[model samples]
Target: MNTYSDLRLNLFCQSLLQSVGMNKENSLVVADSLIKANLEGVDSHGISRLPIYAKRFGDNRINIKPNIQMTKKSSSVLMVDGDNGLGHVVSYQAILNGIEMAKQNGVTAIAVKNSNHFGTASYFCQLACEQNLACIVLTNSPPGIAPWGGKDAFFGTNPIAFGFPTGNDQPVIIDLSTSVVARGKIILAAKQGNHIPDGWALDRDGHPTNDAEEALKGSLLPLGGAKGSALALAVEILTGLLTGAAFGPNVKNIYDNEESGKANVGHFFILMDIEKFMNLNTFFESIINLLNEMKEVPKIPGIDEIRYPGERRKRDKERRLQEGIQLPPSVEEELIKLAGQYNVEFPIPIPPLKANSIVSN
Candidate 1:
């Protein structure tokens, strides 16, 4: 189960969700959203999160049949309430609404309250680029990162994602957590017994700690020291505060606590029609030409070929589609249990784990 070809993985996801009583249509959408993270090399937010979803569902903490409602809707701006539905499904619907608004008004801003973690922010922003639009998205999570010089966490480890259309190439999409390390990274380290590099987080005493367990109990560091903390504060206003959703420590540990309340996580989506700013083709062509020239700069020894922010993930997605995806053993085991509970057949492995029995990353 750790390794599965693209088609096989898709089928497995469908079967697993189906066993949980999700209809085939809903299962496929959820599966695609989760597996797309694996294909993009963001395993931290990939199918490994299935256990979390299962726990929530078992506890009745999530309304499997969410009543998605629009709190406010307009030509250029909108607001929604997720009613604690699955994050990916809610996010997809909201973002699609924003995309349509952009078509009419040349730009749109959509915010949603009372949602759960929606995996990667990039997943939503990239949609705009596919439609020849520029996108800027932000999401607010449970507070796990602290502002500089602060002992307690104040702002969510907010992420800012941007996707710009490019000429004859994948869109230039930049998605990053504002913290020195995203909580997902901490989860990854804990799973793999990997020690984090310096500056990622601190223990409860405000002291730096490489221990993944300690970091999880403590707080993540902010990016750029104070500057990133400031930006995170701004993001809180745009996404959480603006939407009247959970803001700081109140939104803690939605992943592990079955008794916990709905996360009430919030997200903001902004899309600008390319034609509103400039000729879409010209804008993209100029950027591509600039990058082409920049790459020709005299090489420095030891540096790998310079690539844009989204290049590596794009390449990985393409490679993995044919070769298959690899998950950690523990993650694989977790997935299998879900498959068994669902009474779904397991899929065949392709490019399975190496002989070492560890993720061959």
Candidate 2:
């Protein structure tokens, strides 16, 4: 296993992005987002996705110097054109605009189009939580899941995320994909030559399979059968259809090397100023009380603690900050190869592995 401090990882990622012609500011934002995902223990959205991003940038599928623009449709409604930029850069700009608009108008809705894979929705939602605001974020991805009872793929994993100020430093965050699991997890499993759990995905013929590689060649199962499909449909409507971006089968998978044209991904965000609804201090105090009450509830059998959504993530982040982020050897090797190809120096020092932990390719 390879371990890295957050600062070194961020700098390495930024250097790679810069070497590929991304502006300093955009590179910094994207790198920070990726590192944050790693810190939070969301490996699927972390540095594992870096090689694909680099390939896209080299292939001209993602624009390095994008002219991202915002259009104000109303006092509280806005639209952003990403100009084929990396989704991290584009979505970050949109969220910033949404936060400002919400502060001025008490609420705001911002939609983005022509983007390419943003790391994760929770990253932006947490940004709003930091400002003492409530946020909901939805994004449409490449079609990788089928609708209810359908064999062929027609919907993206389509994640939804929400964040609320918890009256404390750590906000309540809920982030989930409508699919049974995030597609990136399957991608990681494939990279590691591991098998997925049963019922997570289907083979190309629509039969469930535990093989990650087969799942990749097929479609992912929805979270709750028909219900998850419905939620994914709603996200598609808001993110892709409403935003005039590609939806359903029209969206291009990020890993498709032979696919031509831009990704044209879409994202939708809703932000609310908590202070506008009631006194901020009072609201926070009430939340804290409710959280305490929930904690007092009896635990189920064999359960040690009742954690709220995002608690585990917060804990993981704290531990990783004090310790270091761990990377699979394959991921580290890919990063090293990417650095060499781009003429960027690998910033993190790799430690010699002990016996029995070496991963075979």
All candidates' lDDT scores?
0.80, 0.90
Best by lDDT: 2
lDDT of 2 by residue, 176-257 (tens): 9999999999999999889999989999999999999999889999999999999999999999989988899888887877
lDDT of 2: 0.90
TM-score of each: 0.92, 0.96
Model 1: residues with Cα > 4 Å off, grouped in runs: 351-361
What TM-score should be assigned to candidate 1?
A: 0.92
Question: Which candidate ranks first by TM-score, i.e. highest?
Answer: 2
Ten residues in sequence with the least summed lDDT for candidate 2: 352-361
Report how far off residue 265 is in candidate 2 (Å).
0.6
